[model samples]
Target chain A: MKRNKKMIIAFITPALVTFLVMFVYPVIRTVIMSFFKVESLTASTSEWQFAGLDNYIGIWKTPIFRTSMINMGVIWLVGGVIVLSVSLLLAVILTSGVRFKSFFRAAIYLPNVISAVALAIMWIQYVFSKKYGMLTSFFRALGLDNLAKISWLDSDMKFWAMLIAFCFGAVGYYMLIFLSGIEQIPQDLFEAATIDGANKMGQFAHITLPLLKGVFKTNLTFWSINTMMFFVWSKMFSPVETEASTISPVVYMYNIVFGTKGVTQRDAGRGAAIGVTMALFVLIIFFIFNRVLKDDDLEY
Target chain B: MKKKVISAVLCTTMAVAMLAGCGSNGGAKSNSTSKATSAASSAAESTSAKSKSTEPAKAEGGKNLVYWSMWNETEPQAEVIKDAIEEYQTESGNTVTVEWKGRDISTIIQAALDAGETIDLFDEDYQRVGQQYASKCMDLEDMAKAADYETHSVEALPTALRGWAGSLKGIAYQPYTSGIFYNKAMFKEAGIEKEPATWTEFLDACKKLKDAGYAPLVQDDAYVLYSYGFQIARHLGQDGVVDLCKNGGWAESEGALAAAKEIQSLVESGYYSEYAPDAYPNNENEIGYENAAMIVNASWVPSEITNNTKCDIEWGMFNYPTVDGGKDPATVANVGAQAFAIPDNSKNGQAAFDLIMKITTGAFDQKMALDTQSIPADPTNEEWPEMIAGCKDAFNALTNVYDWNMGLNTDADLKTVIQDNLMKLFEGKMTAEEFIAAVDAASK
Candidate 1:
């Protein structure tokens, strides 16, 4: 037994070392970097200055950072609700004795297969284009001349347009997860619910919904993760210059580190601070999900 | 147990080998040398004897000169320079290896230099040398003097360098500037005789175009700060705006408020196209498609107009118009350029310097101007595209040139505030006072 145990340990050692080198080391290093006044993200250690809480203080003082945080919050909360509700609905409809189940499922999941950049570009150029866009043409077809005249890609409406496009792509992915969860819930539960004189809606609420609590938690976690990484869409939608309406913390961090859009200075410490803040945000959401959504797994 | 030990050893060896294999290629030196030796020997057997007496450096053991061009082959300037490099190699019997890294050359150069890689030569904006890569760049004042670059160009090397890097650090590869490009047919239809010279005339032209049932001005949100900054430059001199940035006294400055008020009036007057907020290239597309009359764009717009669109409309350009009660002269244009810098780690610094000299001086500037359809930095070079000839007059009459507002402002937060509020002002979301106040608060 001792020789077998030693042999097992020997096999696991390489992977353990790799995990430490690849993930754990960088996380710790980033946390350390947040406290310093780093000139460049790629700068050597000696170039870093001990800035303490100054980087955090500086970010909080900037109104754009606050706007970015608020924009992210909206995308997280509002976008989360829309994506989850739509995806759940689609999942229920597809799984509920629907003909062409495979075709519908594949069609819904198609957007997920395309890259985020390509999807965002397609929406910006084809759908949101002011002159002859799909939205404009549709509005005109409906005889809504005023709506057709309104610039969808402009500052006031750009965020919503981007959010809608994002949700369109996001729903397909989450719906697949929900569909799988629905499939696992046995037909026995539905039969039992029907015998108890419950309607289809009642069975969905009492039997289908409760059993999919675990999947909900999983979907919610993934949604939060996606919201935190919200960058490419914001980057693609916004102009060359950063706008308050569309700025995300991740996008702000990118511009800060890169010194883009006329930002002459690069501060890696502040970027790391933003990173730490984002991680904390994800952690808080994770903990809240774990605490509030607790349920025992229903056995067959 | 013996079998297990052998398997473990084999696994570790394979992993280490995989990691070790991801190292440098060193292709620049070897590939360039081999190509040069074969190519040079074939072309220059007879001429090498005569050229060896005049230029000993030309009769060299295959010297590998590496250059990273900031533009890809798609850009006319890059093509012209690449041809020149090929000509230089064949004539001088020296080896040159060039990498067309495009706009992402900064990140590539930074990574290569940080890794202590041989970064012999690279082209980037002049400001980058002083702002970020000063430590890695070699001063080119002696080289510029040797090449007599100042006498040929309209602006001296120090003058051009100061606009970007604040000091002489690199040599100008080519001159590129920004101004307003208008549709001549549209102007003629609006009954506007010529390009506007002052604020009043500009406003009048805009109104005339609107009355003539046309979108007077078309601009993207991306360039809002730049368009507004030119107005600010007119009100406050370049130094005053710089002072505003340093002192955070934007709220106190009448010039800043005046600049905002002007843009607010334009927005209120409905001079901008409905598609003004569209992303870049799209706004230019509007102008190209005759959906709008004019656009404030960079020198590259002329080339982009032909390439990106198929419209057969005649194009004309004018400098940013003068303002009423302005501090600076109307001829003051916003000028910038693409330049080359030699890295301190360069193995062939002299060769790299000579390459730049060869490209920018003599008939090269004229050839570049004609090929690229851009104005020559050398005011002496009379060659220009007929469409851009009027702009050359404005360029020649320039009393001063300031960097674009977006590029000039050093404070990132204030820059963001300026761009956001200006965009809001154009969208009628914020007033002039609110825009200035927001910028002031952010600056503080």
Candidate 2:
């Protein structure tokens, strides 16, 4: 037993060291940094002023930060619903013994392969442009002149327009995950359900969904993670400093740390505080998901 | 067999552990180096800048210098600089590699310097000397004094360009003066011979242009600030601007109201293009295409027009029209572009300084002025861009030249506030008083 214990310890040592160095150290440093007043990222620790949670309090007081949180919540909750629902629907259709599934999957996945900057430009210039845009022309062709005249890229509608574009690019990724989960269920269970006078809807409800609990949890976690780190789309859409409508916590943190939004000052401590808060939020969401969406490991 | 497998795993784990430890050590070393490098650079900058020691000129040898330029290859300014580099290489026999960083120069330079990378020279926004990379930049005051730079520069060196700790830092790579760029042909067609000298006459010209079926004044959302900046300059002056930035004093100020009211009137008069809300250079393009009569833009606007539109535009520049009964009626709002800054860690500081001096004072400056159709720093150089040639009287007699921000050394956020409120004012969403009140609230 002693020799076995020694072998187990030895086997785990490398990964343990990697984790402590890469993950544990940085996280601890960031948490510590959150308490200080950091004027510059490149400044020495001696230059750092100990503010005792002042940085956290300061971010809380900032109206823009609050606005960012509300924006992020909308993206996470509203975008989450649309993405999951549409992806599930697409997955069900694709896996229902549909023909030409391969072609359809590849076509849907095309947007994911493009860079965020290019995709944003295409949406803004080609789709949402005030003149000669796809949406405008389509609306006009359908004789919906009022709808066609609406400026999609205007300040009032920009947030929803960008969100729709982001969802268009994101739906395909989650759909693939759902399709894989559906395919993993035992064929015999569905056959038996059909044999017992169960219709397609009943089979899906009894067998398919229950089995996809693990996949749903995974998809939810990923969606939350993506929502938390929502910077690129916001950045591409705004191009300059983010607007109130599109600002996210990650984008806000980036602006604070880099002073890239023409704010004229860097506050590394405030940025670290934002990071810690975001991490905490994500952790809370993950735990809630795990608790609410319980699943057992089942074999085919 | 189990013993052998366990032993093999143990060996592999130990090796991996050792490798991880080594990697961590390497990372720590790099971080320490970055810190040390930045601190050393700051120290060097202070010493060189304060003492103003005449560092001896070195022999033009095989040493190569690296230059990171903000201007892309396509810009006329970039073309002029490239030609100068080649000329310098042949004449002085010194080697230099130029990296065209364009709009990404800010982030790229910041990251590179943070990583302890060597950057001998770079062109960055003049405000950066005061705001962003102050410590990393070498103070060129002593060099400027030794070179008698002020006399040769286009405008008298303003103290606002000082570094954060109050030292003359970078020299202007190029300077841009903003005003009305109007189509001379369009003006003739409208039966207006002379450019407007006052706000009232300016409006009259706009009316005439409108009567002639031309969009009188075109603007875009991107640079709407320029439209009101000239009027703001006349009201605030340099000192008033500084005071407004430091204290909450903008609400209902005569200058602020006049400027705001002026823009609101122009916007309400239907002088602006229909596509003014479109992205920049689109509405500005109307003047080049002869769809619009005039635009309030920098000296570089014509270059943009040429590049983006196909029309053979007969462009002429005028000083931003004076406001009748304003504090400084003849104020010219001049904006300086990125300047050449040497890194404190540069291995060849003298060489970098020499190259910059050569570019700014020598024939290269003249070439740049001719090619870009903009003013050069050296006013006595006699080589004037054709468009600016028409406005020589205004350029010479200009008593005040302020940045579009009115030279208010405030937070960039305050500038954004001004811009946003100004946009709101133009859009008819807010009154001039409300706009000023908003700025006042933001300042507080």
Best by TM-score: 1
Name model 1 segments beyond 4 Å from true: A1-22, B1-13, B20-34, B39-59, B72-78, B91-100, B151-158, B162-167, B359-372, B377-382, B385-389, B406-408
Flag clash pairs in model 1. none
Which ten-residue region of model 2 chain B has the weakest summed lDDT? B24-33
Give the clashing pairs for model 2.
Answer: B153-B377, B154-B377
lDDT of 2 by residue, A1-300 (tens): 356666667667767877898799989988989999986665567878999989889888776688789989999999999999999989999999889999989888888999888998888778887666799899999999999988776556777988999999999999999999999998988888899999999988878888899999999999999999999888876664355667788988887787652245788899999999999999999999989987765633
**Least accurate 10 contiguous residues by lDDT in model 2 chain A:** A256-265
Identify the CAPRI category of the predicted complex in candidate 1: medium
Interface DockQ of candidate 2: 0.28
TM-score of each: 0.90, 0.82
